[model samples]
Target: MTYIWTGKRWAYLAMVIDLYARKPVGWATSLSPNSELTSNALKMAYESRGRPEGVMFHSDQGSHYTSHK
Candidate 1:
């Protein structure tokens, strides 16, 4: 997780990178980091990438990622 100073307060940034191209494919920013933040980024990446199959995801063992939601 990365925190950015927006001048007034800190904001969270979630990003999904296309490892093959070494570029960012999707991203989201919010005041808080939660399942929604990560999910939204992943969803955007999935849709933007044409919903490819057999993809692999890696992340830290955060509860948000482990949540059933």
Candidate 2:
């Protein structure tokens, strides 16, 4: 997860990468850095990859990533 300045306000970005592929498979941006942001990115990656099984996820353990929301 990261944030970028969009000229007006900061925008939060959540990304999911396929390490084996060394590329991003899904991403989402929002004004708030929260669990929903990460969830949306993960959901997109899951759906885009046809909802594969036994997949593993990794993160920096940010609050949003660890949040119960």
Candidate 3:
């Protein structure tokens, strides 16, 4: 899961959940949320759970989750 500052200086967080385990895996936040904000959450997921061979991640249609640029 990835969370970035929601308002006024990225002071909030978002939680990432694992569907397979139905558990809260990783969370990310920053004063200025950006690609790296979510990236860190993804990295945390892997580090804590070990590298997955074919892990599938899902998320709602959010800018951070969809923006490629």
Could you arrange the candidates by TM-score from highest to lowest? 2, 1, 3
Task: lDDT winner between 2 and 3, please give it.
Answer: 2
- Expressed as tens digits, the lDDT of each residue in 1-69 for candidate 1 is 578999999999888899899998888888998889888888999999999999987878687667777
Which segments of model 2 are wrong by more than 4 Å? Answer: none
Give TM-scores for every candidate, taking all chains together and pairing residue i with residue i: 0.88, 0.92, 0.68
Error of 1 at 6 (Å): 1.4
lDDT for every model? 0.86, 0.92, 0.70
Off by over 4 Å in 3: 1-10, 67-69
What's the CA error at residue 14 for candidate 2, in Å? 0.6
lDDT for each residue of candidate 3 in 1-69, tens digit (9 for 90 to 100): 333445654464656788878997887767655666777777788777878788877777677777674
Residues 1-69, model 2: lDDT tens digits: 888999999999999999999999999999998899999999999998999999999898888888887
Q: Which pairs clash in model 3?
A: 1-16, 3-14, 5-10
Q: What is the lDDT of candidate 3?
A: 0.70
Best by TM-score: 2
RMSD of model 1 against the true structure: 1.2
Which candidate do you rate higher for lDDT, 1 or 2? 2
